[model samples]
Target: MTTTAPAPAEAPASRVMAVPPAPAADAAAYFAARLAFHTDVADVHAALAAGAGDFAVVDSRSTGAWDQGRVPGAVHLPTAQIPRLARQFLDPAVPVVVYCWGPGCDGATRAALALARLGYRVKEMLGGIEYWIREGYAVETADGTRQLPPDPLTAPVGTDDCGC
Candidate 1:
């Protein structure tokens, strides 16, 4: 026996429960929130290199993971340490950008929320350090600094950026 796809009109309504997309105004609001809450690795690298000290970059991984490698200038502020140690190391006035291992992890989100609750402005780096390294950005380690070629699956292999 063979099966074929249903015609759009013939498809059951229950099988096509798609909601209309957000209106322009709603979409605008959504994009604004997205821009406000997320920053990508490339932009973070540019901002750090330009010395835009308006925000602090923080790594929210454990000490052992941190010792493995980290964004060069990121502060080692593990999520568990935030309440007890945020004030001592972070300035509430400066906005913060936090990252953890990668997309598979929520440590960055938890850290961002914690810092926000402590009255610090915060944004979570979307791809975290994994994407940072995947995109061929340098990471600081106990041995010094290292960078790997961009994983083509994660970033354009060469020739300028992805042109986004």
Candidate 2:
């Protein structure tokens, strides 16, 4: 009797799964290139209060917004007027910190770029006036404004020399 081996079992077909490629390194490089300095609202307040050498704060929001409220001692230039008013408020050699409405706004970015182009050292306040008020920092109002004694959550511990 012929002993023929049974036909080999058929193998299931294999599939080639498609996967999305990761973003190129150059993409991240490009983004990093555009990014400049960033600082939190509290640090900015402390720096201003501490009298950081020759540093100035510039508000990049509109006049109406500026009138509503702003960081104490911040000069309002507005993003549109940065080219003309930058030199008036900011010295090219000194550092200027720019801020707009809030963290989600980019108005400060444009103002910072304008200042940097004009040869001024500049940085953006990460959280702007919104965070400043939220963090319990003193904000000057048109009518009148006053700051209560610094709270533990808002200001650092120790005496005024704490160097927050």
Best by TM-score: 1
Give the TM-score comparing model 2 with the true structure, all chains together.
Answer: 0.67
For residues 1-164, could you state the per-residue lDDT of candidate 1 as single tens digits? 99998766765556345776788999999999998999999889878888888999999999999998999988999999999999998988999999999999999999999999999989999899999999989999999998899998888886536777
lDDT of 2 by residue, 13-58 (tens): 5554244444788778765754558777877777778788667889
| lDDT score for residue 8 of model 1 | 68
Residue 161, candidate 1: alpha-carbon lDDT: 66
Which parts of model 2 have CA positions greater than 4 angstroms off?
Answer: 1-36, 146-164
For candidate 1, the lDDT comes to: 0.91
Residue 20 deviation, candidate 2, in Å? 16
Q: Candidate 1: where is the Cα deviation over 4 Å?
A: 1-17
